[model samples]
Target: MEVKKVDFRNKIRHQRIMKNTSAEFTYSFPVIRGIQAGREYYTTMCPLKLVPRLFKFVEDDLPPDLRAQRTLNKQRIPALARYIIDNKESYAFSSLTVSIDGEVHFEPTDSDPIKSKLGVLSIPMESRFLINDGQHRRAAIEEALQECPELADETISVVFFVDAGLNRSQQMFADLNRYAVRTTRSLGILYDHRDPLAQLARTLADTVPVFAGMTEKEKTTISNRSRKLFTLSSIYQATKQLLRKGKNDKISNQEKKLAFEFWKEISNNIPDWNLCKQKKVAAYELRSDYVHAHGIALSALAIAGSALIATYPASWKKNLKAIKALDWSRHNKTIWEGRALIAGRLSKAKTNVTLTSNLLKQTLSIPLDPSEEEIEMHYAAGKK
Candidate 1:
C-alpha cells in the first residue's frame, strides 16, 4: 500500500504562496517525511527570515487552559536574541517543533526508490502554523533579524506535525515536555565555556590544593556517603559572591588571583579542612559534624571575605586567620542554630547566608553595613 508520489517544481516558492490562498496554492518546502508512533511527521529546513512571518506565536490573550502552547515569555527574548547576535559565528539552536492545522502535500523526489522518504512538503498558505516547542528560538530569530538582517538567509531546522485541533496540540506540548529536565548546575558550569566566573570555578576545582581532589564536578549536592568535600557550583557561587561580580561579568586577572589566594588562605586556616587534606580524618566526618564543612560555610566565608577586603584592605588575610579557632560543630546551637542551620540541618536560604556572613564579619572584627545590621535586628526581633 504505497502512497502516491507527487512531483512539484523546485521553482515553486513562497512568492506563489502570497500570490494566492486558493486550494491549489501551497507554501512549498524541501522536506524529508517520516512516521513515528503510527503518526506522519516531516522535517524541513526553514530560513530564519520566514520564521516570524510563517509561524505565529500562540496569542497570549488565550488563557493557558485553552491554549495549545505555553505563552511566550517576552522577558527571555532579549537575552536569547543577544546569544545569537553576540555569537553570530558560532551560535547553535535546536529544531523548532511545529503543528499545522490545514491541508498539506508531499512531493517525493523520483530519482531513486531507496530515497523515497526524501521529498517536498507544501502547506496551504491560509493554514495556521503554531509552534509546539522552540517558541523562544523562533521569537529570538525574529528579533535577531532586526539587528543582523544578514542572518535572515541562515536556516534553522523545523519539525512539523499535522493536526486539526487544539486538544491534540496541547497533548503534544505536554508529552514533549514531560521528560525535559534542566541539567544540574555544576554540570552546567563544567560545560560552560562562556561565563568568566564559571571558567574561574573550573580552574579552582582543578588546581586549588583544597578543591583539586575532592570537588564534585557534576552534582550540586554531595551525598553523605560520597567522598567529595566541595561541589563545583558551591565553588562557583562562593567565588562569585567573594568577587561581588554580576552574573555575566568578565573576571580580570587580578580578580582571579584574589579568588585563588583567598580560598587557599581559607583552606590553610580551617582545622577540619587541613586534617582532611592531610588524611588524618575522613572528609564525611567533617561534613557530618561541622557547619564549616558544608557549602554554606564557603558562601558565608566568601561574603565575609568580600567585606574584609573592602574594610581592611591592608590586612584582610590576617583577619581571615581568626577562623582557625572558631567552633564550627553542627551542634553549636548557640552560635550557628539560626545563622547556618535550621533544626540541625544546613540551610542556604537568603537570610541564612546573611546571618552566617554577619557572624563571620563580627568574628573578624569587620563592621557591618546598614543593611546587614537591619537584617540582624529583624532576625533578633523574630527570636523574641
Candidate 2:
C-alpha cells in the first residue's frame, strides 16, 4: 500500500465534490481544437459554482396526453379556436436559447447537465426565453409560459458561444434574409443617379447628336414641342432595361453606341421637320401616330425601349438611316433669308431707299448731320 500527504485546500475541494455528487456539471469553457507546435488536442472544462442554485425546478408532473390535445373549444368562438387548433403542436411547448456575456447559462434546476459538453442542442427541451429565432416558435412558448410562472427560473438546454472574433451570428442572419422572397417593384425608381445604369443613360445621352450638339435654338425648338426631350430620355432608359440580361450579360460599349443611334432617329424623324409647317395636318398625324401614341407616357425607361422596337417591326436600321440623311439646317437658313428679305421690302415700300457712297468713310463719332441721301442710305441699310 502507498500513502501520500495532501494539502488542506485539496482536501476541502474533494469534500465539496463529494457533498454535491448529484448536482450536474455543465462546462463553461469553449470546446475548441488547438495545435501546439506538432501535436493537436481537444480541451473542455467545467467551472464550479458558476450557476447559482435556488433557481426553481419545473415539470409537467404528467406526460402530455396526445388525445386530450385534440379536445375542442370551437363553435361559439370560431377564429381563435381555429388558430389554436391549427398551431397546437407549436403552442404545446418548445425550448429557447439565450446567452449571457457570450456564454450560455441556464438556471440550476432538476434537468441533467448535458453529457456532451459541446456544439448545439439536438434533443427536444424547453427554456425560459428565446434569443434569436424570434418570430417562429418563441411567441407560442412565451404564451404557454405566461400561464405557468413556476417555470420562470427553470434551467433549460443552452448552447454557448465565444465572443472573440466570431462571425457565425452575422453570417446566419445574412443567410436567413438571402432566401426570403422579395418583390423587385419595392426597390423604387430604377435609376439611382449614382448607379451604373444612370451612367449608361448619361453616356447614351452624350452620344445622341440632337443632345450632344444641341444649340440654344435647337433646344428651344424641342422645348416648344412640350414633351420632346422627355420622350427621348424615356426611350433611352426603357431600351437599356429591356435589353438587360443576367448578371454576366453586361451592356457592352458597342451596344451603348447602338442605343444612341436608335435615339437619334427617334428624335429627328418623329415629327418630319421638313413638312412640319406646310403640312401641319400631316405633321400632327405623324406625331399622334408615332411620337405621341408610341413615344409618350412611359413611366419606366426599359418599357419605353421595348415599346419602340415593338411598334417599328420592319427595318429599324432603314428608318434610322433616313432620319440621319434628312437636313434641318437648309430649311432653317431659307426661313432666315426669307424673313430678312420681307423686312427689307416692307421698310422700302414705306419710304424711298438711297445710299450716299461717302457716308461709309465717315468716323462713327463725327456726328455729322445728314441730308436726304444720308437718311435714305441709313434706311436702305435696313437694320442689318
Candidate 3:
C-alpha cells in the first residue's frame, strides 16, 4: 500500500486539556495515516528517507545534553540496517515513541470515537523531535535508506507524546525497558536455523549417543526433574572447541561426521552416560554426582579431545577409552578439587578449564605442552 502525502488544508489543528482521576495535563499530538503490509495504521509513519532529517540523536555538540535521549550506539546500527535492507519486503517494525517540546495543535475528526478524539498533530518547522525509544531502529532506518533509495516510500509507525521535560522522558525510557525479557541462549540456538552452529548443535543432540534424548533444547539450566544433563548451547560451544571452528567458519559434511564420531567415542568412554541412557542410573543422579555431566566438563573434554586428535589422530579413539578408568565422581576431591571444583563448588573459570583439560590429556597419555604442565603444577601446589 502506498502512503499519500496529506494535504495541508485538510489537516486539522486544535488542542484540548485532558483530565483523569489522578492527574490532568494537556496532550497535543498529530495522527498520521500510512500504508504498510497492505494495511493502514493511524499511528504516525515517518518515511525511512525522512528519519535522518527529523530525528536528532544525543550528541556532545547539542546544547542541554540532559534533554537528549541516550547516546546512539553506532556499532549496533549497521547490523540492524543490514537486516532492513536485506529483508525490506518482509521486515516488520514496532512503533517508536517520539516527543516534541514546542507548541502543537490537535484538531478532532467528526468520526472520533466516544471518550477519544482524533486529530492532526502539527509542529512548527523549527521544532525537533526527540526519541524516547527506538533510537537504534531510527539510526538503522536512516542508514538503510541511504543504500536503498527505493525504501524512501516505506513507512514506520511513530507515537507522539507531549514532552513533559527531561525527567518524564527518562522515565519513559526506563518504563519501556523495565518488563522486557531477553531470550535464553539455549532457546535461541534451538529455534534459530540461520546460524550453522545452531544447526549443527541440533543435529548433534538428535544423532549423538550422549546428547540423544539427554539434552535440554530450550532452557540453559536443567530443572530437578528435567531428565537432561546438557544444554544445546553448551553442546554448541563444546562442538566449536572440538571442531576448532570460528564463529563464522562454514562446516562441511566431513567435519560434521568427524564431530559425530568424536562425541560418540567420548560418550562410550563415560560409563555413567551409558548407564543413564539405559535408565539404570537416573539423569539427576549423574548430573549431581559426576563432573562429566556438566557443560564445564564437556567443554574441557572437547578441549582435551582437540589436543588428542591433533597429537594422536590415528589412535585417538583407543586412547579416549582411558577416561573410563579415571575417577569422574564429583566427590573425588583429590582430582576434581582445584580443577573442575573450587572449595567444593563447581567453577567454570578459564584456570579451572585449563586444569581440567590438562588432567584429561594426562589420563589419555597425551603429553601436555609446557604451558599446560605449568597450570597443572600451579593447581597441584595450591591444593597442597
Please report the candidate that would top lDDT against the real structure: 1
lDDT of 1 by residue, 1-384 (tens): 222233323422652432244324567788888998898899988888888988888579998888988888999999999999989999999999999989888889876865888887878878889889999999899999999999977889999999859899999999999999999999999998989899999999888898988899999988977778899999999999999997779999999999999999999898678778778888889998998888889999999999899988889898889987889988878888877888888899988999999999989998888999999998788667
Q: Each prediction's Cα RMSD?
A: 3.9, 26.6, 7.6
What is the lDDT of every predicted structure here?
Answer: 0.87, 0.33, 0.79
Which model scores highest in TM-score?
1
Model 3 agreement with the true structure over 1-384: per-residue lDDT tens digits? 222243323322223333453322232335754343453324565666667777768554555446445677789999999888878777888988787766665555556564235456656555667788888999898889889999987777787766768787777788878898889899999887666878999999999987899999888888977788789999999999999887647899988998999999988888888888888888888878889888898898999999999998899898888888989888999889889998888898988888888989888888888998898888778877
> lDDT tens string, model 2, 62-163?
343311111222232343333334444442322222222223332222334453333221111122211322222333323334444443433233233222
Candidates' TM-scores? 0.93, 0.25, 0.79
Q: Regarding TM-score, does 2 or 3 come out ahead?
A: 3
**Runs of candidate 1 exceeding 4 Å displacement:** 1-12, 15-23
With candidate 3 superimposed using the best TM-score fit, by how many Å does residue 90's alpha carbon deviate from the native? Answer: 6.2
Ranking by lDDT: 1, 3, 2
How many clashing residue pairs appear in each of the predictions shown?
Answer: 0, 3, 3
Better lDDT candidate (1, 2): 1
Better of 2 and 3 by lDDT: 3
